[model samples]
Target: MEVYHLYSGGKDSSLAAWILERMGYDVKLVTISFGLLDNWRHAKETAERLGFEHQVLYLPRDTLKKAAEMCIQDGHPNNAIQFIHERALEAVAKIADRISDGTRRDDRVPFLDLPKTRSLEDRFSVAYIRPLLGLGYKTIRELTEMLFIVKIRESEELQKADYEVELRYLLREKGIDPLGIFPRRHYQSRVLGWKTEETR
Candidate 1:
């Protein structure tokens, strides 16, 4: 069976795709862009490096705008991000019978709880899978290290093509400084490619 993995060119998503592939599922990386930035190309490149078929899905721009507004209203990025993630899940459900993501067990934001996940499955007749939901930070990082090379940095330093980057852009367009809303210390990763023999 084929699984369309929502990819962000980050460590978690990359690792999730690898795990899914190892388990015998054909994994195709899909990056959702709300038409704010062309940064989704970062994920496309990383997907190629990882040897997974990849595509960019241009979604409704209103979804991005609403999430940005939610950030300003809520004074945090968590719920807004989760809202966007849920929307993405719903949209992808229409494209394939199976949808997957990199959301981890410990991740608080952009996650689907049991009830919500089940609801999505029931309503869309789709199988929602997040392979990393059972894996924590250390285990995921260790496993990623064995399979791929990644670049890690504070999110401010132009990290991977995660949604936050575009969300921050949209927030700024709405006259709200992202620094005023988003946490400053958050770090993210970008998967560069597979680890060659010498590096591994």
Candidate 2:
């Protein structure tokens, strides 16, 4: 069956795609760009390196921001991620009927209610799978290393992202674990800080 992997230009997603291809699946890479990170370049380079076909999907900034806000109001980051994932899936499924992602069981917690539990056809209106859900990050990294895949360095914006820490600080002030909430797009320090750039 044909399969398409979500290509985030991150180590996990890239390695996941590599593993699927090695297992004799006809795979392609699909990336969604928010225009904040140079994710397009990273995904493109990785696809070329792996000799896999790739495609890019772009979403409007305002739409994403509104989604993020709604997610926070709902008191969960998973909701926000699910919303974005569904959007990505919709765009990707249009091209290839089958799809997959790099999310692992550990990355998706019990509280998160990820779509992993559902069969591929249930999660999206197309065939889908997550082969790496049973594997840990370390093992995935090892596999990628063995295949000589270069890790995509975090974008300058992501490298400087303090949103997590900032959120953690805010949570600590409220006496909660910073990691409790699923991180939304606006939760990224770079995206939130864009407004302050005008003052400087």
Q: What TM-score does candidate 1 reach?
A: 0.97
Model 2 residue runs over 4 Å out of place are: 34-38, 60-62, 71-78, 109-120, 123-125, 149-200
> How displaced is residue 151 in candidate 1, in Å?
0.5
lDDT for model 2, please: 0.57
TM-score leader? 1
- Model 1, residue 96: what's the lDDT? 91
Show the colliding residue pairs in model 2: 77-182
Model 2 is weakest, by summed lDDT over 10 consecutive residues, at 186-195
Full-model lDDT for every candidate: 0.89, 0.57
| TM-score result, candidate 2 | 0.63
Going through the candidates in the order shown, the clash numbers are: 0, 1
State the lDDT of candidate 1 residue by residue for 36-150, as single tens digits. Answer: 8999999999988878899988879988888888899999999889988898889889889899999999988888888999999999999998999988889987898898888
Q: Write down the TM-score of every candidate.
A: 0.97, 0.63
